[model samples]
Target: MTPTQIAALIVAGAFVLLVVLLAIPLVKLGRTLDEATVAIRKAHENTDPIFTGANSTLTHVNTQLERVDGITANAKTVSGNVSALSSLFTATLGGPLVKTAAFSYGVSKALRARRKRKEEPWGKHSRRKGGRK
Candidate 1:
């Protein structure tokens, strides 16, 4: 009946209307959130097998890399051994082999020179006979 009481009632009614209007959208938002959560869970479930397969492939690749690393390590060791053996063989055999080769070459050259000297006398006799004619 009073003007102040009427204003208070109008304000309360307006607040109630605002709450009712806001509740509809809030309910819709909650449902949408629930649907999104379900869809995300399903997506994760569907991709689980793919993720597992990728993990298995990665594990296999790691295993293969380990084998490759082992092979490389063995190859490196073999290379070192071969280099050392070559050095040892060179040190043991290189000097005597080089000396023997030099001696054999010198003897062959001396024999060839002796043969050439023996033929020189016949070559001079033939040249002198030809000049007389």
Candidate 2:
């Protein structure tokens, strides 16, 4: 072959070798992209139900919390009512009961002192400021 023809053939052969080298990596890249797509699809399928279940669980928890709030409100109302009842009872009977107790105690003390004086006419006692000696 002529020298020019041989040089042309060598250049063509170099181009073919380069193309083959580049084609190998391109093919591997395509396979890697396909694997990544499959993995993403699998993850999407697995997480769909998980998200749905989480939404339902949150809804149920919210409903329970609402019930708890209602119970707390009822408890507060009952507590207020009991406090009002206690105040009413104290207002209606507290003063009279205290005064009656004080009166009874005074009467009993006077009777006991008179009896003691009769029994011990000459006994020494601590005299009050202006009472009979």
Candidate 3:
């Protein structure tokens, strides 16, 4: 064979070896992409039920919140009513009750002072002198 032909044959063999080496990695990359696609699909399938459950839980929580809102409204109304009743009681009876308490305290103090004066001995002089009056 000629030297030129032999050189061309060697070049072709090297080109084939290079293509074979490149193709192996390309095939492995394609397989890895396929696995990634499958994993994504499985994750999507798994998350659907989780999302549904979350939606249901949110719905129940909202329902409970609405009930709490109703209870809060009732409590607010009761508080307002109690405040009005307290104001009414204060307006009606607070002044009279204070006056009565003051009068009773004054009467009790006067009675105690009178009783103390009477208890002092008739034969003994009062705080002014220790000798008999």
The most accurate candidate by TM-score is 3
Residue-wise C-alpha lDDT for candidate 2, range 103-128, written one tens digit per residue: 99999999999889777666565354
List where candidate 3 sits over 4 angstroms from the true fold: 1-3, 120-132
Model 2: residue 41 alpha-carbon error in angstroms:
1.6
lDDT of 1 by residue, 19-41 (tens): 99999999999999999999999
Writing each residue's lDDT as its tens digit, candidate 3 over 3-73 gives: 99999999999999999999999999999999999999999999999999999999999999999999999
For each candidate in turn, the TM-score is 0.63, 0.64, 0.80
> lDDT for each of the candidates?
0.91, 0.92, 0.91
Between candidates 1 and 2, the one scoring higher on TM-score is: 2
Candidate 2 backbone collisions, by pair: none
Displacement of residue 43 (Cα, Å) in model 1 is 2.9
Candidate 2 lDDT trough over 10 residues, lowest sum: 124-133
Residue 32's C-alpha lDDT in candidate 1? 100
Give the C-alpha lDDT of model 1.
0.91
